[model samples]
Target: MDIDKLSIKKKRVMIYFIEAARRLMASEGVRALSIRGIAEIAGYNSATLYNYFDDLQHLTLFASMSYLRDYVSALSGNLKPPMSSLQRYRVIYETFDHFAFRSPEIFYNMFFGRQSAKLPEVVVQYYALFPEELKEHFPSVRKMLTQGDMYRRDEPIVEELVRDGFVRPENASPLSAVVPRLNQTYLHELVNGKDISPEEQHRRFIAVFDYLLETAK
Candidate 1:
């Protein structure tokens, strides 16, 4: 549903529901989410929640995004100018891993799970309803957060590498493709209880990423 088309009252109700879900996810984690639970916290019944969202997963996706605030906020400090495009990319991913590994399930569901395809639209809807959450980000950072496709999100950085002559034009696509896959490999394991510490996970990911960059050059 287009949130922009909704009545003011309806938009308010949806915010209530989304906020309730966010509270639950923050307090108890994503696995504890349920339609009844969200509706109860929102001061509505489950049927009313359906009026605002297609299903629990839909609501969960929006709720999970609340976790991204920390990641997005950290980028401002980590991605200072005078850094090369490749350095910026590395900092971005490292910053991402710092937050993502701590909440692997939420990150996995938001980016790699079945509902991930709907994320671009959901992100638009989310910001429409809560534009305040976006006001602090720089324009480039805003664009990066709103880009829902993991591959497309990283493609520009790879293209920057090509423009800067760090990578050949022919290698840009493959470099973009492999980087996300490599991250996903670690994320998938972490999500599945791989028994790795977040610190170890961060180190491993950067080591492998550095190796890939060397090979791509």
Candidate 2:
């Protein structure tokens, strides 16, 4: 549907359904999400939901995009200048850590749940709703929107580390590799129902990142 063509009533109903999905995911986890369940919460018949959304996946994706505001908010504040690329990289992970650990269910569904959709598509869709000011914080989105593939801003950061002699040229590949390992570890722990204290979480992330830095050198 052309969002511009949506009537006021339709827009309001869509918002309610998205909000209902958010509440259900927050309260019960992603496993509890269903078209019928969300429709019941929104006080509409299940079939009525199809008027606004393509399917349950479409609704879930829309609901998940709501949290990107927080991600952009967290990232935008910490980008003050004189910061190194390495420092910026750390800040990105730190912000993501706080976001994902706080809402693992939503994170999983938004990201890891559907193997069907690509990350670049999800990123484009989420940021389409981003306010203009917030959109300024994400340069990668422009490339992803144009190219229709995941764009890693960190790849250049790792390259810079090698060029600056912070990382040995031969070890540059693993520096990039380490970040996704850290991400996977976080998801693994969350999926296994293991909890780490905030302090430990901070310590572990820093430890792993530091190890990569040291080994790269």
Candidate 3:
């Protein structure tokens, strides 16, 4: 296989698998994600998936990366002509909420329900939406760090580049990394598996999220 041809072949296989996974999750939920089932869904044998990925885990990871990329693109489209960094972040967040609600089976299956927490590099790069999509998530995060206000936020406020957005910080990541690093503080088992009331779960998760969102405001 020549390099270009090999890339094209791989791309088609990946797309087929992504569609299969999406259909399965749309109909049967994440638990429906078995190697056999995905193979069937893609009109190929399980062996084909092996050629593209080591196992079902990698396949699903790839699907998730593609999904997030499409997700950000779609949300960005629904926003005003050109949105600011904060605006872009907020739009994507709301889009996430909507997508989660509409496709509970698929969304839950891909996340929270998966045994893996491995976010692929490709996924991180495309949905960035900030200075660069890969680290676009950084600007909002860095913004949070620089501010010490109920909102007296101001470090480098200039509208000299990128049109709707500002030039990204020269010194970034020290504080903003904490935003994307939020999953580090979250505990799924404690919240999802326990006998706690709904209110309690809301209170706990909200508290964590509130602190984060508050700083952004």
lDDT of each: 0.84, 0.68, 0.48
Q: Please give, for residues 4-100, the per-residue lDDT of candidate 1 as tens digits.
A: 8999999999999999999998788888999999999999989998887778888888887766666776875688789999899899899889988
User: On residues 6-55, what C-alpha lDDT tens digit does candidate 2 reach at each position?
Assistant: 67687678778888998897788777999989999999999999987777
Candidate 1 ranges with C-alpha deviation above 4 Å: 136-151
Better of 2 and 3 by TM-score: 2
In candidate 3, residue 57 scores what lDDT?
57
Cα error, residue 8 of model 3, in Å, equals 7.3
TM-score of each: 0.88, 0.72, 0.48
Q: Indicate the residue-level lDDT of 46 in model 1.
A: 92
What is the C-alpha lDDT profile of model 3 across 125-179, one tens digit per residue? Answer: 2132122434443444433322332021112222222233333443233224443
Best by TM-score: 1
By lDDT, the best candidate is 1
Which residue pairs clash in candidate 1?
Answer: none
Model 1 / residue 158 / CA error / Å: 0.7
Task: Note the residue pairs that clash in candidate 2.
Answer: none
